[model samples]
Target: MLASLAMVGLSLMAFLSNSFGQERKIDQIYLDLDKKYRIPEQWTVLPFELEDPYKRIKNGPPLVNVVNKAKVEWISRWIANPKKVVPNAKMPDLGLNFEEIKAVIVYLSSIADKEVPQVAWDAFLLKKDDELSDDEYDKMDKIYNSGKGVWGRARCTICHPIKSVGGNVGVGPDLGEITTKINRNWLYDWLKNTKSHFPDTMMAQFRFSDSEIRDIVEFIMRDTQFMPEEADEEETTEAKPEQQEIQVLTEKEFSSIRKDNALAEKGRDIVEKARCFVCHDVKGIPELMPVVEKKRDNLAGFEKLLYEIRCLACHRIQEKGGTYAPNLTFVGNKIKMGWEQEFLQAPDIIRPLSQQMPKFNLIEEDAKVATEFMDKYLLNKELPQDVFKGEAPSPEIVSMGEKLFYDKGCNTCHAEGTKGGGVVGPNLATVGDRLQPAYILSHIKNPQQANPQALEPNFNLSEDELKAMVGFLVDHVKKKEEGK
Candidate 1:
């Protein structure tokens, strides 16, 4: 049955390729796909406006000339054997084959030849190398090398981007422009423990020696030109007097100081005003019972239940919710019914480096109801038959797709097998099994046709490239079936 379906799909693809003799533009493909699928207007979610805290820091410091040989070498090594640099790191496998690995290595080597822009204070150290005496140069080189090692070992690239290199996943803000916004003292305190500043921050604490921390700080602070001259002088002068005069408080002294505040009354006032327990659980808040009751009442129907659970809090259905998880607006069209059923029951870890959805442990009746609703209502039944019943792609086309996959840096954001890292995009390891060929082609051509809020960028691929990419993905499904 599966083989027959495959043959039909391949034949249709061949016909479509031949019919469209002239190369089709990406926009044309998008229009055609939208005409067929007709994205449901009801599923669309509009974005809400929020206050911006970093609005004042929009402009960054001027670019500085700095190059670190150690940093470049580390990038090259990571490109070659990323797993070795960060063991057990769940990243995309760029080296799916030798050719792909070679292509990536060549790209990294080219990047190394170019001078790295200074984003941190460590760049200053590199800039001073030419002016340093032989002994001083050697010492600086040692410090730079140690710092680069610390960065690689910590897998900082997984969450942060440094210039054109590193992952694009914005789990944390890009450290590439960090020096422009913060000072060394603040950076030091942050590195020591982020939670001390922001109680709800997601950053984890790392155990490093004080010297190791200093090395990392120096490397990060390399581009210190951003700091105002007056501010620098003020900080330097104030440091000594403050350090000498400051009295250290014992644990008992701190506890006594905190006890003087009438915290219970203040807490009650804040909770009453803001309804803090609506999203967060606060102990001993009897007033929150009514809110909990209201939520329970809202979960009476399927749609209301979905809203009550805050499905949009993580999954973007029609671009309305949080972007932390994969968009599910067209999930019915993407995933098979059986697979979706199983997935909802026992969610698997697809993106190991990023957040994973917890198992809902829903009752059988609720699961069945949700599954049925998705299967019947969410499907894009109007997709062309040719998409589902097309001719298999030639081996040559599949090879072209493979080359394009790495050349275009698709693996950087979208993980396949074990090569890519970060959850900036969905895992394409089983995409072939999940998505229809026509839907895949449409998505690659223009993702907004399906979901206006999708983060997947349109590469503006020509007719041949689109066909080849789709073919490559379809072939992935075939290989999985054969256990290749």
Candidate 2:
């Protein structure tokens, strides 16, 4: 689907040899049966396989439909230097010259499964922004603004970073300059059904209506942030030196050689030599790892939810999955089941500074399944049922806690009441509704003990100070009227 390359340049060949030469010398490592056949000590025999999204051998998106997904020109630029096209791109530069890149594009085109359906756009919307009539511009702007609102509600940046910012979830690609990469048609199809393009993708399948999808598409296409920034004229003139311009494969040029079998075979050979199959599912090359087919027909409850939603893509449980989100190994003992279920259905801003959970548009049944799974299995025995002994703390203790909270500068990171604070930690305005009193007390006592990665500091407060702080935080619950 993406462009191809043949030979590594001399410099790159030398670099790769130097970097991997030691491993190449050790053929014995592969031949040693003891090392090859030995079961990993960290691995455990399970009743059934739990799909780890992070552990996929083919890390890049499948190339079977890349020809339809990306433009030949964009693919050429990406193959040349991925980071130059998108700043956070993970694909390393293969150092392919122009001719090899063209052949690869031709090869990708030959393997395409189907044509990309063309999307109908308004005539005025296709016009350049500067060329648009005032009336047409206003109409386009209205749609763009509506799309912006939808983008905000969906919290696209929770996973996807835009311009090197707001990818706290750390799973999605940098979407900044995405406008230069894919066409509106591919984007529209992907948003409509991501699993169809990449079945193993971790992105949530949001239940967006057709109009919502269109609006989002408009915003993404029209937004300046998604487009690459133009270089300054003076800076370009004052640059140290002009490098040789790399030729990009045009659609016209690619179409000419697209059906050439000899060229495609040569491209395939180059791909095999470059080991492109290590990261991508190249059509002709044998996959380095066998694909594990998963059956979802009989899956029900949490197990089904995990695969469908790909929760482990962001979250970790019992040391498996990703660490981009909160560890759920002890979630049962940490959060109130009622709040957990409600949050799963309609997630709110718990952590304003960190990555907030995206609204998955879950049904009541989905929420029930998730909460039930956590409550039954995700527990920490050391955590008490209630640190307050089944009773609310006295008003005096809460008042004292409030003073201690501010005195210790807890508000520097956490927000409380009507006043906003630092966005470094979870907002404490409704902490009582979400967290169990016991977990809060325990966490505050030793932040590192609760979460080794937590930035929360240990104040080493006296027992009374600890109790007072917990009392104050617990009092931050929503009022009865506000709960509605």
Candidate 3:
């Protein structure tokens, strides 16, 4: 009923704008209505299936291969208190006793399909750094540093938050103390074939070479940042009672109980009672709760791309998907289709500090399909077409806008040119080639109205100021060659 009322309001606004041939303040109206009707930070049960991709996604990694992925000790710690291990862990502490945890570990080991692939490392590399000769340590350090460089170039932090920092894209796990959880072999294998391990992962498949993969594994394994901090023994003693020591099933202890069928059955019972299947895909477990799988067999065009890339994991479309990335409800009316298509294929840095589109290795056809769909369906009809009357703003307008740009201190957050500026907002160097003139006007007029989560403050520019600003921004295009 609320949706119908919203639609009616939108339709009425569109009719008024078209009949009078005047630009309506639709953006402000929409923002007002959205704030009033669409409550934030509250969960409500929709009557129909909204198909929120983030909701469909599992917070925990698939447990089928978890035995191979994480160490038994790490698993024990995680089950005890997930937040304690990784500050940003989505998993809750199951509150299972030591014996149950031990049984669970045994059961997991029993169900393991494959062992971690043995990568032959140099004898010195496997040895402790102190045990290694100076030459060996130097060689290891060189490889570690090289991997660190590769890590930065790949922009791993764009998706992954480390110590609750940097996952602006908001898809990856908190990998701050990753060394405590995963072994070097598992990390290497997972990096090599992430899809093979978890088919539903939103992580992009980077085209890294074998050497690069190995280097990343090395860097992650050896890096102090990835490792857990050693607890101060005196402080630890004062903090907790000795009786409160969490029981962990060591590898040796697990090896003994792993083959015990009775224990495995008990573990299965515990898992069922805990409803672990709700978050994890546990093999050899019967359907205690039946799940209806959404059919993706018939999905084509942009829908297929959306599912494959899991675009909804970051981007929000209407009431579906996530809010980590920009809202795409009216992207067609905001962005230039040509630029969007190109960006989908080979993305460039827009927001230098936070937002970055991962290189998904999308084909040209994929980009075309995505952009075409967005252009056709995702638009605001009330926004005036041909905002500048299909003509470039005069030099005077551009010059005034440029002056206002500096006077308004827009450069503090946004960079207009390459030489210097802040990285907090989108780099506006070639924004003219990217965003539509209409969007520029609307965005400048009211930033929060355009994007609820936007940090860009509304300058509340007057009509002339708004027009001039938009003109200046739209003029910031890449200069063409003289011959061209």
Candidate 4:
């Protein structure tokens, strides 16, 4: 019996050694590919471990993190057929031969633990009928699949994730593990009336019926294998501090909130008359077909120029326009007047990485008119006074902020001086001189409020942390001037 046990141990050791050798071979192939293609880190698909799946695990000697065979096959197909997998991926041809691709796929597949469920990719389509009776399960499945069209048409995948699929457009939180994070009833309520929970969210109201909403919730939760203990209905119903208090408003109070004034009415009329909805979706205006085919012929000067240049095609105002450019609704309150004028005239790239905004080549006269129009109409008049009244940061505070800046991974997205760490976000060296203190504070707290399409995530900083970050950003100009 002792001899047999010893032999079993030896066999296990040999198996592990062979596994390690195979993994090393795979790593060598990856290294070769990396050297040849100079592939971006985002493009690199790593082996997924069943336990602690989200965290990136370093490649172990015996390949601890197993890659599913299905995932490997999916990835192989994705690389070969980019148009099918990721239609919008602007990747250059990898120039890899079929043999090289196959080898890599085989290597990836070798790491997979066959015991694990094949639900990493295409998990969204999964309908675990075993959870319910046959008849009820069929009914739910039909109802759930019926809402798939709505999901695609709404571009829900653009901002959300369902296992390995979907783009992280960064407009909303990842919904991949949402079932584990949030309760079904709460999710249902949120789907029905998002504004009630998050008053300033950019998520548009989906006019789905009760049955459709239920179906969607079911579909989202179907593949959730591990539900957290914290995902209680009571906990989900509890509002965050930032969320507005739930209250029943009288007609007068509701009217007060709406605040229909002459200036706003005039602006609405002008926007409607100009047929801005053709290229824009202004917040308050009802959707209508253009009255005239040759609308540009009737308008002249700045109005005509605005439409001619197709400003609405890029820039958004009041959450109503294309998402490619920055929201200009509250730009007047955020940017200094002089800086805005200068930017309009010169049109230099504020964020070197972003190529969305091109040089307009506008003459001084037109630039000035545009600047004045933005300043006058798009201004936020009710900005809080406290943001601008803070004393210069103490040395200790500045030191803490400096440490926190790196600790918080702010450098990953924002460039400081010449160090371009990441290109996803804008440079911050000159931000202190450009943006208002109040706007900076508000933007840091909640970026989505300032720009619906903003990719800057809310870090949920404490008040002290918020102050420290704001001080660090605001003092950057002073530090630069002092040659610190």
On TM-score, the leading prediction is 2
What lDDT tens digits, residue by residue, belong to model 2 across residues 1-484? 1223334466677888899775555566576977745545523333345677887767788888898998889999988888887778888889888878877877787788987777788898777799999999999999899989889878889788999987877778898888877888888889888877887787877777788888989999989999888989997789577687768888888878889998887777777777787778777665555455455679888887888778887888766698878988788888999999899878888776566777777899999988987887777766755768868889999999999999999889888866778788998888888888999998999999889889999999888898999998888788822865
Among all windows of 10 consecutive residues in model 4, the one with the lowest summed lDDT is: 47-56
Look at candidate 2 and give me any clashing residue pairs: none
lDDT of each: 0.53, 0.82, 0.79, 0.54
lDDT against true structure, model 3: 0.79
Query: Which prediction has more favorable TM-score, 3 or 4?
Result: 3
What TM-score does each of the candidates earn? 0.39, 0.84, 0.77, 0.38
Report the error of model 3 at residue 154, Å: 3.9
TM-score of 4: 0.38
lDDT of candidate 1 over 1-484, digit per residue (tens): 9999999999989998888865856787888888755646544231222111122121211111111222323333443454544433334333323333233223222223234233344433544546877877777768866876665555556445554344434434445445544455556666664433432333344556666666776667663322223457667666454333212223343334333334434434443444434433333454554222222332343463354334444565543555656666667666666656666665666666654654444556656766776666555555534342667778998899878888888887777763653467767777676666877887888888766767677889998898888877776663675688
Q: Which has the better TM-score: candidate 1, or candidate 4?
A: 1
TM-score of 2: 0.84
Per-residue error (Å), model 3, residue 80:
3.3
Candidate 3: residue 478 Cα off by (Å): 2.7
**What digit string (tens of lDDT, one per residue) describes model 3 on residues 1-484?**
9999999999999998898877556688788888756734323222233345566545555677688889888888888878888777777788888888888887887788888898877677677678988899999998889899778767788778888888876678888889878887888888877767876677655656788888888898888778767778897778665566776768888777789988888888888889888877777764664445566577677776676677777788776787877988789888999999889877788987666776665778888988888887777766655558769999999999999998999899889874357789999888888999988888888888889988888888899998899898898887721222
Model 2 lDDT on a 0 to 1 scale: 0.82
- List the candidate numbers ranked by lDDT, top first: 2, 3, 4, 1
Clashing pairs in 4: none
Output the lDDT of residue 339, model 1: 57
Count of clashing pairs, candidate 1: 33
